[model samples]
Target: MDSTQELIAQGMKQSVPWVRTAGIEFTEISDGRVVATLPDVAEQRNHVGGPHAAVMFGLGETATGAVVLAAFSDVLDRAVPLVVSAEVRFTKLALGPLRAEAVLGRPAEEVLAELDAGTRPEFPVHVTISNAEGVTTGELTVRWTLRPNR
Candidate 1:
């Protein structure tokens, strides 16, 4: 497994409520990218009987944070990344299992450099949550900040 995959596996083993509750599982990680899946179950359903917006948001946040953490592992020092800001838009009602992916793309190097400068870099990660049909159910742009622990 690569560094990104290893990191995501470690995170899965130490699953939190937000992950377990939503049945979110890390499926893939590479470079500065992360993909997580969330099953559409009764627990994740909203009053309208569709996936709750909060659950989708949680998956996006988790995926984005994982990308930033993987990209700046040196600065993170195994520390957890936090979301400083996020903008989410619900494009359609989500039903069934959903996949959320975050990709750092080619800008990873520049973002890592900024983090190394110790200026508390805010990495903007794009998260796309889609249903089985590959239709995007929601989109989120999350800004994650990494803090090194002494």
Candidate 2:
């Protein structure tokens, strides 16, 4: 809805080939929260006829990335954000359209202060995956780092 959100979403859609191929849409983006959705078409289904695991992972990762970028966009010129690690668990068969919501694990102010002190900061973003019926089907946690561009 905001300019930054729009720019980030548009830029990612164009720059990330896999994002385009998978039809991921960033619906909400703010300082510490982000939400993304994946269409539940045949192309997104897996062998079980539900949403594929990889696609769900992609949505989780992308949602987290957007929240991080929104909170740290000011420091991006000096540091490049990267995913250090990720862990995901599929709880149920993800049928129908899927939604992923992500939030920062730590306070944005604390993380930004570390960056201001010229130290690389690592933070976790936790995401919950749910189907159109509002039932949770997966959980994902991603550890992201802002490595200073030397």
Candidate 3:
């Protein structure tokens, strides 16, 4: 595992207060992939007694952001990673705890190459939210961008 990935995971949990409130757990963070788990807490449950849709959205977005940070770790000091937009489709109901895994649309190397060339690279991260039963509850495509901090 990359030290940068570890740093990103730590920073997200420590620095981002809202992310901490969502109770997201980073299970994996690699070059182009990230996995997170969101517990089915009572506060996060919907009226139907299932996990709320926003919980999945938050977990999915968190996982996608982790991948973006890990992918651009080399230039993170000079760049800012932001989520421009997200398109999520809720399919089945979230009956239990949610696990979300996000994958970069393009290879990490390719995204870096674009950023290295002075282009604001926008990456589409695909997230699949699944329940303990391995049933997919939602799918999200989050568009992330890396811009010069200055």
Pick the TM-score winner. 2
TM-score quality measure for candidate 1:
0.85
* Order of models, best TM-score first: 2, 3, 1
Considering every candidate listed, which one attains the maximal lDDT?
Answer: 2
Ranking of all candidate structures by their lDDT, best first = 2, 3, 1
CA RMSD of each candidate after superposition: 2.4, 1.0, 1.6
| lDDT against true structure, model 2 | 0.91
Measured against the true structure, the TM-scores of the candidates, in listed sequence, are 0.85, 0.96, 0.92
lDDT to native, each model? 0.77, 0.91, 0.86
Q: Write down the worst ten-residue block by lDDT for model 3.
A: 1-10
What tens digits encode model 1's per-residue C-alpha lDDT throughout 1-150?
676577665775475555665677788877677898888798778988878888889889888766765676565553457778889999998888999999873476676666567555567789899999999999999877665554
Candidate 3, position 88, lDDT: 96
lDDT per residue for candidate 3 within 1-150, as digits (tens), equals 467667888888887777888888888888788998988899889889888877778889889988887777788888888899999999997887889999999887787788888898888999999999989999999998888777
- Give the Å shift of residue 51 in candidate 1: 0.8
Better of 1 and 2 by lDDT: 2
State the number of backbone clashes in model 1: 0
